[model samples]
Target: MSTMDYDEHESKFMRKARENPFVPAGMAGFVGIVAFGLLKLRSRGNTKMSVHLIHMRVAAQGCVVGAMTIGVIYSMYRDYVLKPMEEQKALNHK
Candidate 1:
C-alpha cells in the first residue's frame, strides 16, 4: 500500500490566511498616494524642516488609522467568529 499525502495539516494555515484581511485595497492606495505627495512636498524652501516633518507625520498617522481599521475588523471577525468555528471543526475532526 502506498502512503497517501493528504494536506490535512495545511487547512488551518489556509483558513487563517483567508480569515485575515488587513488594510483594504482603497486604504492601501491612499497610503501610497500620501507617500507620493510627501515625496513631492519634500521642499527645501525657507520653511523649517520640522514643520514639513510634522505635516508628513500627520499624513502618516492618517494612513495608520486607515490600516488599523482593517486590523480591527479582521480581529473582530477572526476572534469572535472564525476562531470558534475552527475550534469546533477541529474538535469534530478529533
Candidate 2:
C-alpha cells in the first residue's frame, strides 16, 4: 500500500480504538505477552516447547480477560458515576 493508504488505515484503526479502548488494550497485552514468551523460550534438556506454548497461550488469554474486566469497570464508572454527576451539574446550572 502507498503511504497515504497506510495513513488512512492507521487513522481508521485509531478511531476504532478510541471508540472502544479495551480492544487495543487486549491486543497489546496479548502481543506483548506472546513476544515475551517467545523471547524466553529455550529448548533445553527437560523442557518441552509445547508446554511453554500452552503457558504462553494461557498468559495471553489472562491478559485479555484482565483487559475486559477493566473495560467493564470503566464503563460502569462512566455510566453510573460520571454521567449522573454531569446530569446533576447541568440541573444545578439551569
Candidate 3:
C-alpha cells in the first residue's frame, strides 16, 4: 500500500481503538505473548511444539481476559466512583 493509504488505515484503526480501548489492549497482550512464546520456543529442549503452541494459546487467552477484566473494573470505577464524586463536588459548588 502507498504511504497515504497506510496512514488512512492507521488513523481509522486509532479512531476505533480510542472508541473502545480494550480491543487494543487485548490485541497488544496477545501479540506480546505470542512474540515472547516464539522467542522462547527454540530453547525448549525435548518439548513438543504442539505443547508449546497450546501453552501460547492459553497465555494469549489469559492476557485478553485480563485486559477485559481490567477494562470492566475501570469502567465501573469511573461510572460508580468518579462520576458520583464529581457530581457531589458540583452540587457543593452551587
Candidate 4:
C-alpha cells in the first residue's frame, strides 16, 4: 500500500466556491416546487384541467419563496461568517 500526503491549505477560489449559496437555494427551490405540485395534485382531483394551472402557480410560488429564503440566509452567513473566516485564514496563512 502506498501512502500520500495531501496539502491542508485551501486556495481562495476554492474557499469561495465552497461557500456558494446557489446550490442550497436551487435544491430548495426544486424540492419546494415538486412538493407543492404533489400536494396540489393530491388535494385537487385531476378531472378539471384548470387545476393544473393552479398547481403550476402554487408550485412556482413555493419555488420562489424557497429559493429566496435559502439564498438570503446563505448570503447573510457568507457575508458575516465565511468572509471573515477566509480573511482570518489568509492572515494566518501569511
Candidate 5:
C-alpha cells in the first residue's frame, strides 16, 4: 500500500475509535426512563403526560440528577479507589 493511503486509513481508524463527546444512546435511554418515570406520576391515577413532553422534561431532569449522582459516586470512588493508590505511590517514591 502507498504511504499516503496507509496514513489516511490509520487516521480514519483512529477517528472511528475516538470517544463520542456526547451522551451515548443507552445511557440517554436510561436517563429518559428514570426522568419520565419520576415525572409521570400525576394526580389522576390513569392520566399520562404527553409523550413528547414527558421525554423532554425527563431528559432535562435526568441531566441534572445524573450529573449530581455521578459527582457523588465519583467522589466516593476516588476516595476508595484512588486514594490508597496515591498513598502507596507516595510511600514508594520516598
Candidate 6:
C-alpha cells in the first residue's frame, strides 16, 4: 500500500487500542493474579521453584480469561444498552 494508506491504517489501529475498555482491566487482573500467586507460593515455603513457576503461569492464564470475559460482558452492555440511551438523549436535546 501507499505511505498514506499505511499511515491511516496504523492510526486507526492505535485509536482502537486506546479506546478499548478491556485493556486496563486485563492488565490489572494479570498483575494482581501473578503477584498474588507468587506471594502465596512464597508463603507456603515448601513447593519447588519449578512447580511454583507453573502455578504462576496457570494463574496468569486464568486471569486473562476471567478479565476478558468480564470485559466482553461490559462491552456488550455498553454497546447494546448504554450507547443507545446516550444517543437518544443527545438527539432529544438537539
Taking all chains together, the TM-score of candidate 1 against the true structure is: 0.42
Ranked by TM-score, the better of candidates 2 and 4 is 2
Query: Global lDDT of each model?
Result: 0.67, 0.87, 0.89, 0.68, 0.61, 0.77
Native RMSD of candidate 1 (Å): 8.0
Task: List where candidate 5 sits over 4 angstroms from the true fold.
Answer: 1-52
Candidates, ranked, TM-score: 2, 3, 6, 4, 1, 5
Ranking by lDDT: 3, 2, 6, 4, 1, 5
Better of 3 and 5 by TM-score: 3
Q: Relative to the unseen true structure, what is the C-alpha lDDT of residue 3 in candidate 4, on a scale of 0 to 100?
A: 21
Model 6 scores worst on lDDT over the 10 consecutive residues at: 1-10
lDDT of 3 by residue, 1-94 (tens): 3556445556777866765699799999999999999999999789899999999999999999998898888889889999999999999999
Tens-digit per-residue lDDT, 1-94, candidate 6:
4556445556764655555667666777789878888678757678888888898888788878887788788889989999999999999999
Candidate 2 per-residue lDDT over residues 23-72, each given as its tens digit? 89999999999999988886434778888889899999999999989988
Candidate 4 residues 29-88, lDDT tens each? Answer: 777776766676756665575767676767666776666677778799889999999999
Candidate 1 lDDT for residue 21: 45
**Candidate 1 lDDT by residue in tens digits, 1-94:** 2224435566654554444545444356567767775776756478777787676667766776766787788798879999999999999999
Give the candidate number with the greatest lDDT. Answer: 3
Q: How accurate locally is residue 86 in candidate 2, as Cα lDDT from 0 to 100? A: 100
Task: Give the clashing pairs for model 2.
Answer: none
Backbone clashes under 3 angstroms, per model: 0, 0, 0, 0, 0, 0
Scanning candidate 2 in windows of ten residues, the lowest lDDT window is: 1-10
- Give candidates' CA RMSD values in order: 8.0, 5.9, 6.5, 8.5, 8.9, 5.1
Q: What is the TM-score of each candidate against the true structure?
A: 0.42, 0.77, 0.75, 0.44, 0.38, 0.55
Worst 10-residue lDDT window, candidate 4: 1-10
